[model samples]
Target: MKVEYKKASLGDIQVMQELVDPEVESGVILERSSDEMATNIRSYILAYVDGKLAGFCALHIHTASLAEIRSLIVDETHRGNKIGANLIYKCVDEAKTLGLQKLLSLTYRQSFFENLGFVEIQKESLPEHKIWADCIKCKHFPICNEVSLIKNL
Candidate 1:
């Protein structure tokens, strides 16, 4: 299987939404509107396998020193291909290139992020700015069950 990775384009918004729907239903990822995705489109990285969109992820830089890996979803049929790992590596590369010091992820899949070198952490350890700016807007705020993990880059 041939795999290619590229920055997301405006045209990919619908497919991106489609790819993330199941995860959203299962609460693995937050639901994103097309407008939101379009606004942050540049942060997204898309993976294509044999000319089809297989998965996608986003590297959201919250501050100069911190960034979060968000919206990582691999199509069910595309599992086990390492596409998810590669998408994360791509995010890591971007974070490093931009001189970010840390990457954070809030996920239910602790072992998966741990395998990629992220260490489990308390959500309170995250910056207050992040809490007020992003977490506050989440429907699960203040009582979310997702695990927090960080990787110093």
Candidate 2:
């Protein structure tokens, strides 16, 4: 199967929502509002398999030294195809191009991120900006079970 990667555009938001909402409902990803998706649409990378949107991931820059890999999701029908990894690689490339020094992932799939060379870290080790700006808004905040991981670029 051939997978194509591209930067997300405003027109992709509806499909992005359709692809992400299931994961959010299952408590696997954070909920994203339409406004949020429209505003940060450019930060997202989309993966297409056979010309259909199959998955997505985003690189959210928090500071010159840091960015978070967020909202990674692959369609259930497309799991195990490494489309998710390709999405992540795209995010990593974007982060590097922006001259960011590190990539962060707050994830439930610890082994997955670890397999990609992200090392486990204490949540406290995350920048305050990340905690205040996003984490605090997460429905699972203060009791979130997601593991924090980092990869130096």
Candidate 3:
């Protein structure tokens, strides 16, 4: 199971949408329309196994010094193979390349993220500019179950 991580293009949106649909329906991940994904295509990184899409993660720049790691999902069949960790490594590498100081995520998998060296932080500790813009659109806004985690790049 050779896994490759690559920058996503408009052509990948449909597949990515399909990959995330179930999680969205289950309310575990937020719903993102294809149009919204296409509009933000540059922020996405996709993982493929043997030329088939396996999972995806996105690094969305929130400010010069900060970025958010979002939409990280591994196909159900591919869980526990370290695909998720590889995706996070790609995002963290990108963050370092961009000279960003931190990478953050709002995730339900707190222990998993902790294993990757991310530390839990109070949501309010995050930059208001980052939260106010995107977190506001989250279904759990104002009372999100997702915990905030950050890794210094």
The residue ranges of model 1 lying beyond 4 angstroms of the native Cα positions read 136-139
Candidate whose lDDT is highest: 1
**Each candidate: what lDDT?**
0.92, 0.90, 0.90
Estimated TM-score per prediction?
0.94, 0.95, 0.94
Model 3: CA > 4 A from native: none
What CA RMSD would you report for each candidate? 1.3, 1.1, 1.2
Candidate 3's displacement at residue 4, Å, is 1.6
**Candidate 2 lDDT for residue 42:** 87
In candidate 1, position 53 carries an lDDT of: 97
The residue pairs found clashing in candidate 2 are none
Write candidate 2's Cα lDDT for 19-91 as tens digits: 8987888777888988999999889999998999999999988888899999999999999998888888888
TM-score of 1: 0.94
Colliding residue pairs in candidate 1: none
How many residue pairs clash (N, CA or C atoms closer than 3 angstroms) in each of the candidate models, in the order given? 0, 0, 0
Better of 1 and 2 by lDDT: 1
